[model samples]
Target: MEREHFSRQFDAELNDIREKLLEMGGKVELMIANALLALVERNTELAVQTIAFDHEINRLEMEIDEKCLEVLARRQPAARDLRFITLALKIVTDLERIGDQCANIAKRVKELNLEPALKPYIDLPRMAQAASTMVKEALDAFVRGDENLAIKVCQDDQVVDDLNEQIQRELLTFMMSDPSAITRAMRINYISKCLERIADHATNVAEMVIFMVKGKDIRHTIA
Candidate 1:
């Protein structure tokens, strides 16, 4: 009876950790969305709020890490359980970096808010949407153990990459055509780069998810 009770408690603890990780990922996804929304609507207030949200993400990271560590020390989980705990640690790092990227985007949005928008933000919103989707799907895949979805996330990164290159080229043309637009164009380019980095982080999460599910290291092996 004592062993059974202990097993149940251990399972509950694992679930709690998983839940906390999901919470962190959700905040990151929201951060990406809010950052882009601020850029599109020219809402500096929203950008500031998005930047502030990062503190919560940081707190969650530490909280989740502590939980995972406690489980490791107390339970001495092995096999899949060990993988889940270790991967959880690595995933929180990626998620936290994604939050940082969103904050970076928010900061750039504030700076760009001071100037007239360089263009109508044609591909940027699309890029942000794609990157944001990657983040959401990556987290979902992780929690759900959906290997196919994780693979799809890995495949989807190319779309973000292409959009980034296209944005850079267009901005370059803007800089070449009008010296006055250079500053705004460069800021916009930086945001594009941030989104790209976020997508990269999402890909990292997806890759780790693949490893968690199949016990295989697919990093740098996919595409």
Candidate 2:
């Protein structure tokens, strides 16, 4: 009876950690979406709010890390339980970094808003949407233990990459034609790169999810 009670308590602790991680994931997703909206709509207030929200993400990361340590020390989980805790630690890092990228994009958006409008933002928003979807799907895969959904997240990264490349080419052409347009072009280029990096981090989480589910390390595997 004592052992069963301890087991139940351990499971509750794990569930709490999972809930906190999901909360962090959802905030990061909102940051990504708001950063793009601020850029496209020239809403400086939203951009500032997005930047401020990063502090909360950072706090949640620390809290989650502490919880994982507590579980390790108390539960001494093995096998699948051990894998899940370790993966949670890594996933929180990626999510925090994703928050950083969103903050970077928000900062750039504020700078871009000060200058004249660049060309109509066409591909950048699409890239942001694709990257955001990957994040949401990756977290869902983690919660559901759905390896197939995680694999799909890994495959979807190409869509963001292609859009980023196309945006860079278009921005370069504008800079080449109008020497004065270089400043705005460069800012847009940096924002595009941030969005691409966010997608890469999301892919990292998806790869880790695959490892947790399948016990196979698939990072950098050609697929």
Candidate 3:
């Protein structure tokens, strides 16, 4: 009876940690969306709010790390359970970094808003959307233990990369044409790079999920 009770408690603790990770993922996704919205709409208030949201993401990351450590010390989980806990620790770090990228993008947006409008902002928003979708799907795959969905997330990263490259090219053209537009163009370039980095982090999370599900280390393997 005591053994069964201990098993039940351990499972419950793992489940609670998983839920917290998902909650953190959701908040990060919103931060990305709002950051892009602020840039496209020139909404400084929304940009400020998005920057403020990073505090919660940072806090949750610390809390999740503590829970994972407690589980490792007390439960001494093995096999897949052990893998899950370690993956959770890694995922939270990626999520926290994604939050940082969002904050960076928000800060750039505020700067851009003070200046006159750049171009139509066509590619940056698309890149942000793709990166955010990858994050949401990757987290969903982790929760559902869906290896295929996670693989899809890895595949989707190239789209964001391509968009980022296109934005850089377009912005470079703008800077070449008008010296006065150089500062604004560079800021937009930085925002594009931030979104691309967010996608890269999401890819990292998806790779970890694939490892957790298949017991295979497919980090650098071709899709």
lDDT of 2 by residue, 1-223 (tens): 9999999999999999889999999999999999999999999999999999999999999999999999999899999999999999999999999999999999999999999897889899999999999999998999788999999999999999999999999999999999999999999999999999999998999999998998988887845
- lDDT tens per residue, model 3, 27-124: 99999999999998999999999999999999999999999999999999999999999999999999999999999999999999999997788888
Global Cα RMSD, each model: 0.9, 0.9, 1.0
The predicted structure with the larger lDDT, 1 or 2, is 2
Candidate 2: give the clashing pairs.
none
Compose the digit string of candidate 1's lDDT tens values, residues 1-223. 9999999999999999989998898889889889999999999999999999999999999999999999999999999999989988998999999999999999999999998877787799999999999998998998788899999999999999999999999999999999999889988999999999999998998999899898988887876
TM per prediction: 0.97, 0.98, 0.97
- Model 3 ranges with Cα > 4 A deviation: none
Q: Measure candidate 2: CA RMSD.
A: 0.9
Clashing pairs in 3: none
Model 1 error, position 59 (Å):
0.6
Q: On a 0 to 100 scale, what is the lDDT of residue 219 in model 3?
A: 89
lDDT of every predicted structure (CA atoms): 0.92, 0.94, 0.94
Deviation of model 1 at 31, angstroms: 0.7
What would the TM-score be for candidate 2 when compared with the true structure?
Answer: 0.98
Clashes of each: 0, 0, 0
The worst-scoring run of ten residues by lDDT in candidate 3 lies at 214-223
